[model samples]
Target: MRRFCSVMLAGVIAGLGVGIGVKAHAQAAPLEVRVVVVTTFELGQDRGDMPGEFQHWVERYPLEQSFPAPGTEHGVLRYNAQDHVLGLVSGEGPSHMAAAITALALDPRFDLRHAYFILAGIAGVNPYKASLGSAAWARYVVNGGAAHLIDSREIPADWPDGFTPLQGHVPDEYPRPPLHSIAGDMAYQLRPSLVQWAYERTKAITLPDNAALQAHRHAYQDFPEALKPPHVMIGDTISSETYWLGARMNRWAERWVSYWTDHQGEMVTTAEEDIALCQALALQAKAGRVDAQRILILRTASNFDMPPTAITPATMLANAAHEENLPGLHAATDAAYRVASPIVRHLATDWARYKEHVP
Candidate 1:
């Protein structure tokens, strides 16, 4: 039914002035390959080092784009191996990152069965509970910087906690609490089942021969049980523009003005593109395109929000080099993969069996 529906939809789209290639995309029920890993930044250890790593890996997969394959601007490597089709898209920021994920998910040929969206980049943290290298997952991603203030005049007189009655309530500068979304629930809820599947499958399957895969496998098996439901806060928080201005300024409250000018917010957290991806996956799951249980989101922290003078190159370098920080990220990334991989394998196996029965 799904295949028939998609094929019909593709035909309709094609007939309506859409390109022929796109119309032919629905010939089959889209490939139900396992495990699509996405990274906003490069698959490298740091911001400056992602391109080389990205370039080296793209060599493994043949690309469909006209431009030169991976290593070039926004080059992609799409492939299917061991029943799992993987996509590697590079660069950062929300708009680009979101588009990349959507592209990978919507590509009818790839059959992206189960997706693991790993926001593999650095992030700013609370600095106290969250250190430089600690791996935090977002149970609740708060959209801090993107909120609009509801003016006192526009607000009703009886809304709970409404500021209309306050003495100093400025009509223009009303404060509003931030909005939050539960990001990792789709991913987090699957952890235990995934881990169980991992242990069961480890005995029968041969692990991948790739260096990153092997390292990832080892890291997955060793994941600490305490760190479930990883906290990933997505927002514009870090900037170098304020680095030089630290010492000259005495008043700290005014420092936010400089950062807001550049980064657009003081510091906030929200899911990168997980919300939209989750929505898409939910649709796919309902349509029986992918196993909902096999999906997960893994993210790594990069930095901490601090006074301008506090953040130095040396500080960032030290944070990056900090044993706890990098190891935690490596561990968390590995943990997520370790758990999700087998669940993906299980779903793929089931899908393959189902395909055999289709005839």
Candidate 2:
């Protein structure tokens, strides 16, 4: 009986050791991500052939490991284990982006506490501010769709395209209700110092230019900025689910961005997902899952927000629908990767310094 009792005790102790080992392994399973590259969509497979927002990062980094992201749009996340870099596709629009980013942030498999997020994507450029294929580092991302709207035909003649701030009496109304009282999350302001640093680091990048892109720019001869070659610049983004085009809507976008940022932001790139992505990141930051200040938004112009001189909005839409790809699609994608890769590499390689202090 004494021998049997001793054996039983030994067996219990061994089981306890196994339990502790399993717990330790689980705790160590989570990846310590240093940098996250967030793209809005992927064309087909992650590699080979035509590149989408996610392809260049995938092929260039050679992300060899893949993990299932059940709820995300692409349903998978790519990882470069050696560099501790993650590539994610948040889907195409605001809803998809929010869901995917939120899911990723909440996942226990990734330790994002100190991770830097780079949202690189393509957008419609404001012809007056930027040319096709130009890249812009955003200082502010404003939600252009969060407002009261009236049909243009029914709106007061004095009103501009029938868009007004929530609970405001007029278009671009000021001294408005406090943010929390109304739709408080109308705009997200990134760290200006970081944005400036990124801009300075990449402003000299020469974007891809070809005869086709040049011809597109020539059509916008009236707009001096649109006629220039593709280049990197510091600008702001306006995000709306609706793909709006026309001079009147462009004016509305300009006003909306200016109003939300108190005239500190100029509308350069118009996109659909950045504001939603920012909102998710902000919430995750509040939850202590990620660092909001480390997020960088880079948008390259794939097309113009408004039709070029003499081209009607309907005609431009028709042309776009028939084309296999936008005029600046390739150029914009190349520029986005070229401009953002340096920052991503620096942060991932020198993580010891950036993990403690955001550069």
Candidate 3:
């Protein structure tokens, strides 16, 4: 079934077959923005007027259209008619992401009715599932943030970790909030057809490789996938505000994703900003401003969720560059562009076919 858009037009004169009249109108034609790539942050952090951020996006889509509203951040809608993709930056973190998305959804500048939104960013990979520099297509986004943490040192002895679900209590108990309760359920399931479609397009593309990346990956020889170079895979993301570390926290994150998604999704990338992105998009969908199902999240791993067995958590954290692997960062970003470009191009070039029927 084709999902046809139903919008009331006010500016144009219709039915002019020898029996129509003209009407006074005062609005320019609504711009049709096909694809909106929402990236969290640009460059080495900080809010600056930088023209370049996404390497592949900047190189491929050089045509930049200024933002249409006031008070919103100064970002352009990058266009690549040749490739059929548009890009935007959502700033960073929970608050910034919420504001940036609200601006775009409510801006009254472009027609986002049929636009496909892609959330592309780097994240910490769960070594149990994948290796550094690998990219993943998420079917579920679980909010590892906004939790009721009691502190591992202070929590009940039997409880798995300090972090607990909203209104949830006790040791190893799943959240059992009231019926239709919106407090505890944080997992957002995106359109599966769209996820599969995007995954199929660029999964074969090789992610960037480097000696540093390989050396770090080698530490996890026990895990088969982590031993290989970065590759594309299907997984879920755990979005948390707390910069958590250690295997205990990793275990909690893994369980949190599964618990929220009903064991349907395996947690892969541990990153920030995804839940914020999901909430904003969900509201926009409810308002009939954008198609919620059209949104997809693609996260790449720049580092592992936790260090290997040989390295102590304290020792690993003490390392000068514990948070990010430079090589993995480059590889992940490179892989993000490679995996997303083809799907974006396909949607842009074949809009007529995918308009109502999701690929």
Judged by TM-score, which candidate is best?
2
Per-residue lDDT over 223-268 for candidate 1, one digit per residue giving the tens place of the 0 to 100 score: 3321222332222222221222112221221233222233233222
- Model 2, residue 33: C-alpha shift (Å): 0.7
lDDT of 3 by residue, 220-317 (tens): 87678788878898899988877777788889998888877878989888888888888888889889888888888999887787888778767666
Which segments of model 1 are wrong by more than 4 Å? 1-30, 43-73, 83-85, 113-119, 150-294, 307-359
Residue 152, model 2: lDDT of: 85
RMSD in order of candidates: 13.4, 3.8, 6.8
Query: Candidate 1 overall Cα lDDT vs. reference?
Result: 0.38
Candidate 3 wrongly placed segments (more than 4 Å): 1-26, 44-53, 68-74, 81-84, 171-175, 179-185, 318-327
lDDT of 2 at 336: 87
Count of backbone clashes for each model?
Answer: 14, 0, 0
lDDT of all the models against the reference? Answer: 0.38, 0.88, 0.74
Residue-level lDDT of model 2, residues 60-137, one tens digit each, is: 866779999997779999999988999999998899999998999889899999999999999999999999999999
Task: Please tell me which model should have the higher lDDT, number 1 or number 2.
Answer: 2
Sorted by lDDT, highest first, which candidate order results?
2, 3, 1
